[model samples]
Each structure stands twice: as C-alpha cells, then as structure tokens.
Target: MIAVRHIGPPRLTAGLEGAGRLDWDAHRRLHPEPAPLTCEGLVALAEEGRLHGRGGAAFPFARKVRAVAGSAARRRGRAVVVVNGTEGEPGSAKDKVLLRRAPHLVLDGAALAATALGAGEIVLGVADEGSAASLESAVAERGLAARARVVRLPERFITGEGGALVRGINGRRPIPPGRKVRAATRGVGGRPTLLSNAETYAQLAVLAGLGPRRYAGVGTPAEPGTVLLTVTGSARFPAVVETPAGAPLGHLLDLCGARAGEGVLVGGYHGAWITGEAAVRAGVSRAGLAAAGGTLGAGIVMPLGRGTCPLGECARVARYLAAESAGQCGPCRLGLPDIAGALAALAEGRDTGAAADTVRRAVRMAAGRGACSHPDGTGRFVLSALEVFAADVARHAAEGGCGRPVRGVLPAETAARLRLEVDWSRCDGHGLCADILRGLVRMDEYNYPVIPDEPIPARLEGDARRAVAACPGLALRLVPRS
Candidate 1:
C-alpha cells in the first residue's frame, strides 16, 4: 500500500494531514479558510510567489491566469474552470492522494480561480473511483454542488492532457485534436477555460490563504513553495511526499530508504533516468532537475532496484507508451510501435542486428511530429534510457541477454484486444476501410482488405469506428478478440 511522507515542514499538507486519509468534517476543522480576492489580486499573489504549474509543463500560474482573463474578456460568455485530476502517468499518485485526502482544499482553489476568471461553473475530471467519490461528497458537504460538478474520465493516458480533458468535458472524443488550439483562448462551450492539475489548485489554495511572503518561506528563491512527489519502486515506504522545493534529492531518497547508488527514474515514464550517486546531488525543483539532465514531470521519483533488469524495464514501459497513443497522428501511431518493436528485440537480446541503431533512428523520427507532444516525450524517455543504460546495452549486445529478470518497476497495462472483421459476403471490395484506417486494414492483391493477426489496441477505437462508417457495403466491423 502507498504511504504519506512529509518533508521540510508541510505547507500544502498542513494540519489534519498524515498517513490516514482526512474526511470532510476533519478537514473542515483543520483549515476552514477563505480568500476573497479579485482577478488582479490573485495574479499579483501568484506572480510574487512565482507559482508554477505542478503538472509536468511547469508553466507560470500567473501568466495562465492573465491569458485566460484576457481571452474571456473578448468573449461574450463566462469563463470555465477545470481542475484536472486524471493522473494518467503510471508511476505518479500525488494527485490521487490529494483528491482523496483534501478534497475541500482543491475545491477552494477551484472556486477561487473560478471567481477570479468570471466562471460560474467548476468542473473536476477524475479517472479513479475513490477520488471521484470523495470530491463529489466534498462538493455536496460544502454546498458547492450547484456550481461544481465531477466528471468521470477514461483511463487512457492522453485523456489527461489539457486540451483532451476540455474536449471530453465538451462531449467530444478525449484525444488531442490534430492541430494546435490553446485552451485558454477558446475552450469549453466556446469560452475561455482556466485549466490546471489538482496539485496546482491545492497549492493555489495554500498561496491564497497565506499570502506571498509566508508561502515563500518554505522553498528556494527561484521556486518558493512545497511540491508533492510520488515516491515508488524500491523505496521502503513507496509513499507520496510533500517536500520543500529546493530540498536535496539525497535527503528525500534517504527518507524513503533508497540506497545511494541506485538508478533513479525521476519525473515518471516520460522523464529521464539519472544513475549512481549523481542522482543524490540533484535538487528536487524543476530548474535543479533540468541542470541534472532530467525533469520534474508530475513529481514521480522511481528508483530501480539493483536486481531489476533496466533494459527489460525500459522495454516494458516503451511498449505500454506505444499502446497508449491516441492513434490520430502518424508519428505517434507508427513511430511509437516501431520503437517498441526494436526495444522488445533488444530486451530479448536475440538477433538484435542493427536493432539498437534502429531504435535511435526511430526516436529521432518520432520527436516533434505529433499534434500532441506524446511522441516527443516518449522519444526523450527512450533516448535517455539508451544514454543511462549504455553498459547494459553493450552487455546484452555481446552476451545475447542480461540474465537479470525484469522486475517491472515501471507499471504498464495490457492493450485491449480488438480485431477488424470483414463480411466477405457483404463486402464489395470498396477499399474504403483501407483508406480510413490504413494501420488496421490494408488492401490486398485481390483488392480486398487485409488485417493483422494481432489485436487492435483500445487507442485505435476511434479510427476503427470511422473505418466502419466509411465502408460502402457495411462489411468492415470491429470485434473483440475471442
């Protein structure tokens, strides 16, 4: 089970915070606070504290508010506030803990942002059942159900993206659209929407309650505030930690009972790998992580045990990321699978002739080609694996195996099984299915359709439906694997 560990004197996780999850009444007694601030006041406070988005992007919170306010000023309708709590990153669980333990605090922040941005409605999108239930109950207990609502989201990774969450809430497919559209300018219901992760909102609540000076008391001058980190995989406690922003990485690892020389994956699956004792010296802040050739993506710090095969672990996560693609763009759909295939061959250490080189080339081809940055993020992840695990790669190349079993320190989900079924009797060989979903259906020599033996992953369902709709004879259909 996951545990809660606080470091460097808790701020966001103040009184009534501990190992046990806090309920509504208990939370109310601990911190029943309010901050009545105008849009300018909120922006001023954020700018003073240098509040940054707790999500992977690390965008400035004040700039986001200004953008949303400016965008809403042009539109005739009101603005929208969305608290993104999807937490799709496999190794990250900090947002889930906040939503479960301190629902009221999150709502307070959302309500504050909503008032500042002229938004009458607050929408919270959650993936897990426990978070959803707790938030809904909190909204009702605080008598906020009228203006606040909870939306259940699909478990796919892409659904957690900002634009994708807006699309899902607006009743569209929860995939990043094929073009660039800033959610702050034009968002849900054609109005500007202020969207940020759950931790961002919780931090906002803290900043709102304690002004800028007190909020700046915990962290460094550059990043002055406490940040949440989900510490898992080889840590003795495997807990969600709240630590001061500039705390030494070594101290946090030691607190979690991690050894000094272990290989660490900071920032989740999409983050880079830092090896050996050097990982200990890096700071926990975004700027500090960047100096160490890593990121603070979603604040996930995963340590690989010595016994685990790093190559096999990388391959597993690569395959999982490949299957998580939204399947709308060619680079993410085609290139990720190519990278995954090459990594699988490398993991097996069998006939890996040019497979390593192929993996390197695939990463280059995949980067910066998708509508979303999933491809770019995946490329970075795999490229770092190669750099940090160079010795492992050489050993596997020479010996045809590492001889170490994959411990699956990184979590992955099996792709759902689906297949394209063709009714030959009804098929007129229109080739429409091939045109709509070339990845799943291709034209054969006889001008009929050809399908692969493997199953179509869940991410490809939208394309599958479009292909079925485009079929002239209604011959193309998708069926679950038997």
Candidate 2:
C-alpha cells in the first residue's frame, strides 16, 4: 500500500499524514482554499516562485501558461486544462499518493487553472483505479463533473507522455505519434491546452494558497517550494515523500529507512546512478541532482545495497524497458532489445568484455532516435549502469560472475504476463513475426526473430496471435503466463 511521508516542513502533503483520503470538508478545514487570481496574477506568482513542473522534465510552469494563453488568444478559442495524472514511471508513486490522499488539493489546482484560463474543460488522465476513484469522488464533491473529466488512461510507460496522453484522451491509440506535435497549440478538440502533471497543478494551488512569500518560506530562493518524491527499492517501506527543494538527499534517504547499497539511483529508471558520497552531498532539487551527475527525473530514489549483483539488476530493468516500449519508433522497436540483449550478455559474462562495448555502441545508436525519449532514457539507464559498475565489468570479465546474486533491487512491472516464444528448431529464420508484430518482435543480425521477454501488452494480444498464425515455419507462438 502507498503511504505519505515528509522530510521537512510539509507544504503539498500538509494535513495528509495517513493513507486515508482527505475528504473535501476535512481538506478545506486543514488548509485555506486558494484565493481567486487572474491569469496575469497566476503567471506572476509562478515566475516569482520559479515554479516548475514536478514531473520529469522540470519545465517552467509560467512559460507553459503563456504559451497556452497566447495560442488560445490567437485562435479565439478557449484553453483546455489537462491534469496529467498518468504516472507511468515504475518505482514512482508520488502522483498516486497525492491523488489518493489529497485529491481535493489536486482538484483545487486544476480548478484554479481552469478558472484562470477560462478553460473549456478540465481533463484528468489517471492510470490507476484508485486515483480515478479518488478524483471522481472529489470532482463530484466539488460539483465539477460537468467541467472536469477523469479518464482512466492505459497504464503504460509512454502513455503518460504529453502527445500520447492527449491521443488517449482523444480516443486514439495511447502512444506517441511518429512525429512531434505540441500539446499547447493543439490539444483536446484542437484547442490550446494547458497540460501538466498533477503535482504541478497541486503546486500551483499551494502557491496560490500561501502566496509567493509564504511559498518561498519552505525551500531555497532558486527553488522556492517543497518537492514530492517517491522513495522505493532499498527503503524499509515504499513511500511518497514531501521534501524541501534543497533538502539533503541523505536525510531523505535516512528518513525513508534506506540502506544505500551499491550506491543510490537518484532518479527513476531513466535517471543515472550516484555513489553514496554523491547521494549524501546531493540536494533534492534538479540543480542539486544534476550537480551529482543525474537528473531529478520523476523523483524516484532507488538503491542497491550490498549482496546484490548490480549488473544483473540493471540487465533485469533493461529487459523490462525493452518490453514496455510503445513500439511506435525504430529506436524503441529495435534498439531497446539490442541494448537489453547486450546488457544481459555482459551481466552473464557470455561474450567477455566485448559485450560491454556492444552495450555502449547500442546505447549511442539508440540515443535521440525515437519518436519519444524512451530509447534515449533506456540508453541513459544502461550507460549509467556500465559507468557506475565498471569494477563489476572487470570482475565478470575475469571471474565470469559478480559472485553476489541479483536481489531484484530495481523495479520492473510484470503484473500481467504475455510471452511470445520462437521455436528455433522448426524455424528457418523466416522473420515473419518481425513483420507481423512490429512492436513486440524484431529481426536480429542473422535474420532470426527476437521478441521482448516481458509479457505482451493486452492491446497487442491479437497481433501476437496473428503473428503465430502467419508464421510459415510455425516458429512463433504466444502463451499466457500461468
């Protein structure tokens, strides 16, 4: 179960100390409802606070507002406010924790944006049932059903991306388009849309409630506000934590009962690994994390303690990322699996030190080649692993192993299982499966079909079966995980 924890004075998570959802009345009692503000006022406050999206990108909130407002004004159309709650990054649960425990705050923030922009609608894209239910109940409480839509989007890695989430909201495939399309200019119903993650909206509400000066009371002048983070992996218990922006990373880890084994991964899967010394020196802000050689991407702090094989753990996550690709682009479609394959080879010491070089080459090839950044992110993950665990590379080279077992310290979601298997004995490298299931299957160097080892997405089950049927050699088959 998800729970809320805080490191310093809490701003976003105030009055939310337990797992129970704070009802509207209870929430109102605990924190004052935000005073009404005009668009200019909102933008001015955001600039003052230097407010940025709490989501992975840390994008400037003020710039987004201006962009949306300008686009809407140009078209003489109303803006659409989309609260992105589709938290797709595994090992992160801050959005879920907020939606479940403090739904009203999130709604209040969305409502604030809608009012400021004179938005046509407020669309909330949620992934989990609990978040949807909490939001729906909160919307009903505020009598906002007419103005707000709480949609349950596909719970996949890429589904939370701006274009993908917008597509899902528009009743299209919930994956990134083959090309770039900015959501600010064209979004729901082709109107200017002010889209940002749920925590961003909540932060806006906090800014409004406290005003600029009081909001600046919590964090540094540069990053003036608390940030929420999801602490997982080596922590004693998984938690969504509220921490001051410049708070020491070490304190946060200690508060969460973390044992920094094999160093700490400062961000999510896309984030790089930091040594324990860096972790102690690192601040929780984006600047702080960057200084420590990682982005504060998605605020996921994971660690691998002693006794675990770090390379093996990285290989496990690499495989998961390969399987979770939206399959919309070539880098994700083909390159991810290659990286995963190389990482596995290196981890298993299958091909000696050359596999490590292959992993590096694959990462470079995959970078900046996807419709989305999934490939780039995956590359970052594996490349960071190779850098942080160089000693493990030499050990495996000489000893053929790390001696320690993989403890599964990194998270790779596998709730549902769908496997695509190739029968090598009957197969003649027909490679039909590659053509049939473009997303799940790809052709290797020798024309043999390679499939992601993770479960097949439910949406692709039919395509998987078709590939099975179309295989001339009967080399491909799909089997459900029992």
Candidate 3:
C-alpha cells in the first residue's frame, strides 16, 4: 500500500545526520564559515530566498527583521532577539530534535539574527528543563555566555505563543494581552525584539552560509529551502524528517511508511484533517497543503489509520483543548467547553438530536472572539474534524456509538489547572474575584466565590492570578494542580 524511495537532501536537518549534540567544534567544522554579519545583507538574502518563519505563521523572516531593525534604529537603542524553541504543539517534535541534537546550529542562527538587528542580547526560551540545560551548555561551550541566556518556560500550550512568551519572560503572566502589541516595537522590557521559532533560525543558519541562490536550489520556486516534519501516529516509525519544501507529500509519507488512504492530520491540533491518498499527493509546502485546504502548521504530518475511531479521537482532543484555554477572553472560556461538550456527546452517542447544530453554533460563537488567534484556530480545527469525519458522525448518530475504540491518535499535554483557593478565615465576601474571572469564579448564594468543576485552563490562568491579586480580603490564592 506504500511505495518507499529516497526523500532527498536535508538542509535544516543536515546537523542531525550523525548523532548527539553537534558540539562547537563539529558545528564550526560543518559550517566552516560565518554569514555576512550585516543586517542589510541578511535581509537581502532572506528576501531573495523567500525565507518564511517555520513556526507555522510563515511570515517573511526578512520583513520581520526589517521591522524590528527599523524600530530599533529610530529609537536608537539596542534591540533583542528571542529564539522560540518552545515546541508546544503536542504532535510536533522538530524543535526538540534540534534543541537536543543541534543547539549550536540554532544558536548560530540566533547570533546571525541578533547581529543583523543590532541586538546586544539573545534570549532562547524552552519549555522543558532538559532543553534549558542543553542550550545553556551549548552557550557556554560556544563562549556566548555573556551574550545569550536560556530561559525555562511553563509547559502550557499558549505559553509558546510569541506575545505570551514575551510577556512571560518579562515577569508578567504568560498570556496574551487584551490589545495587540508588536514585539518588534515593544517587547523584552520595552525594547524592540526580533522573535522567531527554533527551526526558522536553524534554516537561517543554513541559508546564511549558502547565500540565496544555493539555498533556493532545493524547494519550490515560491518557497525555497528544506522543512522539518514530525511524522507520528500510523507511520511505521514516528520520526522527524527533513525534505525540500516542495517535495511531494506522498513521498515523505511513504518514507515514513504511511500507507495510501490512511487519514492524515496536518498542521497539528490547530491544523486540518485530510484523507489519505489525497494528503500523500499534497505538497509538503505551504502552498501545497493550502491547495488541499490545509496549512503546513509547524510541519506536523500525523497519519490517522482506519483502525482508530475518528470521532473518539476528535472528542478527546476537543476536551483537551477545552481545558487548555488561556481563559483571558469570553469566547475561548465559554464556547470551547460547549463545543467540547457537544463533541463528547456526539462521540458517546448521547446527542439529543441537535449535537451537530450545537457544535456548529458553538464554533461560530467561539471564532474571531479572542484576544489572540486561539478561538479562531480552535474553531477551524473543530470544523475540519467535522468535515473530514462526516460519515463517522452519521454512523455514531445512528448506532449510538462507533464500534471502533478511541485510540487517542492525536497527542495532548496534560493541562495544569490554576486553582482559586478561597480562605474563609480571611474572606469578607467582597466578590471581586467573581467579577474579575467571571467565567471561572461565580458568586455563590451567600456572596462567596464558587469555582468551576474543571481546572482553570491556561488561557484563564492569568485571569485567576489577577483575581487572586485583586482579592481585597487576601483570602483567595492561586495554586497549580499537582
């Protein structure tokens, strides 16, 4: 059912060719040369090569650097560079692979960007402690201890968001602010910050060394260069593979041992679901997946075999997302849970004949309503699941359940809830918490605060912190789930 062949040259993953972390010596040996250390030169190369951020946004990296550099130039202050290695998407592992195996390569890219932007400091953010240790060691080994610092970030999905990351590093709650603030203009203690994900920087390291023409040789004419794909689920060997941007999706899947006709979840949780053979034929590039009504989100290409219950998978992920909300906005707080509940009812065959409509309505209510793209992205994911699994829905609706068991093919991190603990001893029943986190904290009949059955999701974790801080009685405190 699958045809295997050579996948092609690997640029971003070239450092991963051998094993272990590419030490400073091996790194300098492989690279052998540094990029043009000027901002204009780097921007020109980026523009010519059409290099985009590999962190799912696909924004032109050159343009982003120019924006931050321009801002810094006008302000006459040193800018900051942030390397986002917090690969929070559960189905994605490319970032971690780079962090563990090729820290120096990633840092080289960061150094390039920092030099281009005239930034004095470079900050690398990682979710896990192991990555922090690895990066720290790499910085010391490369004699970058004075210029680069490694930061440990909370392992929450939303914390990986660019703005939230900036806020977190600044000692604020790691959540998106109500208003949009460009990091290029205002970030990292009010200085211009050039921020991008890890793989993006790794690609830049390769591009800067090769220059535009040679770097553009491998991928499509529109989007040139190699991409890192984390293949999981039904693949024979779940792995992180590197292929030229325009490589046929089918070949990449085949290389990973995915059979034809197996469903694929492209772009991770916020991405869409596409059927097997069609997905395989789709290009691995942004334009390729766009034609298939999908996006190459974080280059996560997961195969969903026929053996798993598609509805069950949807339900589990939906619930996990429902609990992962940052709770900063109303739609993300209220609508996600309702949508998750509807999906759960549908999966369990307990829908009251209106589950489909309820899901559609909740999705509509949730989209375009949050401070960040969380609501809209979550809605898109749910909508795609509904569209791709239409037949499965009908089967469940009629049979009271799909016979196949729930195989949680999709991955999710266990969410840590921020709990609002009410101390009656210090309580004056002022009810300010009920006002601040209205969605999570409710006013009891006696004016005390009543919390929800579920833990405080990430989106609302900041709000819970706010509620605790604002509590006049000092009775309320925020605690994490053990």
Q: Would you give me the overall lDDT of model 1?
A: 0.83
TM per candidate: 0.88, 0.92, 0.86
Off by over 4 Å in 3: 1-6, 260-262, 417-482
- Poorest 10 consecutive residues by lDDT, candidate 3: 1-10
Top lDDT: which candidate number?
A: 2
Q: For model 3, how does the per-residue alpha-carbon lDDT over 1-482 read when each residue is reduced to its tens digit?
A: 01112257656566565556777887787775465468988888788878899898889999898999999989999999999988888888888888877788889889988887778999998998768888998999988989999888888777788899999889888887888999999999899999999988888889888888998888899988888888887787677888888788888777787764546888888888887767978988999998988889888888888888887788777767777767667787787877877777788786537777788899998888788887787888888888888888888888887798877677754665556677889998888887876545656558777654345665567777888888888998877665
Task: Give lDDT per model, in order.
Answer: 0.83, 0.84, 0.81
- Give the Å error, residue 304, model 1: 0.8
TM-score of 3: 0.86
> Over 4 Å off in model 2, which ranges?
420-477
Please name the candidate that would achieve the greatest TM-score relative to the true structure.
2
Q: Going through the candidates in order, what is the number of backbone clashes in each?
A: 0, 3, 7
- Per-residue lDDT of 262-366 in model 1, one digit per residue for the tens? 478888878888875668988999988888888999899988878888888988888778878887787887888778767767877844667689899989888
